[model samples]
Target: MKKIIEIKDFTKSFGSQTAVDNLSFDVYEGDIFAFLGSNGSGKTTTIRCLLDIYTPDSGTLHLFGRPYEFSMSKDIGYLPEERGIYTRSRVIDLFVYFGNLRGISTKDALDNAHQYLERVGLIEHKDKQVSQLSSGMQQKVQVGLALQHHPRLLLLDEPFKGLDPLNRQLFIEMFKELKEQGVTIVYSTHVIDEAQRLTDRLVIINDGKRKAYGTTEEVRKTHGSEHIHLEFTGKFPKRSELYTSVSTTKTAEIIPNKGVDPEEILQELLASDLRIISFRIDLPSLNEVFIALSKDE
Candidate 1:
């Protein structure tokens, strides 16, 4: 895949507090890249730097293999973490205005707006004032406007925030369809479940640094410990020469040393007197791995 966005040693500061420090990552073409972090972990700030909404104190950013340029704005659609729209304007009218900025005619913008509204299941609310719509509805409007011009790259900061399950699903479906059409998508969020399901690659920031970065599996393998979950018939092993950090219960968790294979360990258990009923490899979930690394940071 081609590199869509690249940030090299990106650092940003506000007053005296560092928001992002020496962060480096790459977003590939036609990928749904997840910009993941917990609250105040610099997800938004990194995105702002990518969009040139905020300038970095140090480091380099490249979008589409080039430095920041206003002309490129039309090719990149951005939906900020704080989703907002012109409260006084009709939803459809707002789309028209934003589309015009991207050089679309009013007639074309209206057509595009309604088409997007239909996909997002908000066509009935198109003529309503932005202030009158619910927060979720307003979010749909913001997304509609962002996509009005069908930009090649979509940068959505916390796109699923403040959304009900149904509405979130709607955006997920829309994004999947867009991805199928080969549009590169980058969305930032603190919600791990959504990111796990939606993303092809992920970069997780913690305390202004990259805690994890790569394909989900790569990141997991890097920072997430591989473990064996064993359910035994009797005499749970609390201490083993092969495994440490043995957590006991009806089902016990045995965290082996790095590079230890579960299959090799299984042979040892079979040689013992302890009756083993079942065993499975337990790879840490993205949420668990991220929280663990974030806490360490």
Candidate 2:
């Protein structure tokens, strides 16, 4: 895939506190890249540098093959972690206002506002004041505003925050639709489950550093972890020697040490006196990997 955004040795600091330190990564075109990190892990700061909201103390950021600056802002849509609106403003009115700020004409902005309201299933509430909508509805409105201008790239910071399951599903469906239309997206979140489902590639950040990056499978492999789930019918058998390569033999489930064949281990179990009724081998979820890495810190 073509590269759309590149951060080369980017570093930023506020006083003596370093928010981002020598971060480097590439966002490929047409990718739903998940930016995973805990609070204060430099997610927002890196995004600010990418958007030129803050001039980095060092390094460079390229957006769409050019140096990043506020000039490129119109080509990108951003949904900040904090959701805000003029409470007294009508839903459609707010959309129109924000769209116009994004360079859409008033007439066309209002038309697209209504269209996006309907698209997000908020058409019935278009005439209502922003304060009249529930918190969830307000969040959806922010998303609608972000999409109003048909931006080439979308930067969503904690988009799923404060959403119920149904609304979260709605956002996921909308992201899938956006991906289908070839929109490159950078989604930042601390929620691992949502990231795992919505993203094909991910960059895991911690302490202002890149902890892991790549396709989900590739990241898992590089961390020397696998999803190996095993359930024995009877009492769990004693630890096996061959399983130690990737596993902590103390537990039934194994973490591969050197990509050992789990089937070979199973075969040895069957040959031994251990009785087994059930077994399963599944990939470790992102949450598991995240926890493992965090513990290593």
Number of the top-ranking candidate, with TM-score as the measure? 2
Local distance difference test values of all predictions, in order:
0.85, 0.81
Off by over 4 Å in 2: 240-252, 256-260, 271-283
* Candidates' RMSD to native: 2.9, 3.1
Worst 10 residues of 1 by lDDT: 238-247
**TM-scores across all candidates?**
0.86, 0.89
Q: Candidate 1: misplaced stretches above 4 Å?
A: 229-253, 257-261, 264-278
Q: Candidate 1 — what's its lDDT? A: 0.85
* lDDT, residue 11, model 2: 92
Report the lDDT tens digits of candidate 1 across residue range 1-297: 789998999999999999999999999999999988888989899888887889899998999998778778778898888877789988888888888887778888888888888877888988889899988787677778778778899999888878778778888898999999899999988889778878899998887898888998888788878878888876665445678755565677778876778888888778777788888897767887888888895
Per candidate, the number of residue pairs that clash is 0, 8
Q: What is the lDDT of residue 191 in candidate 1?
A: 86
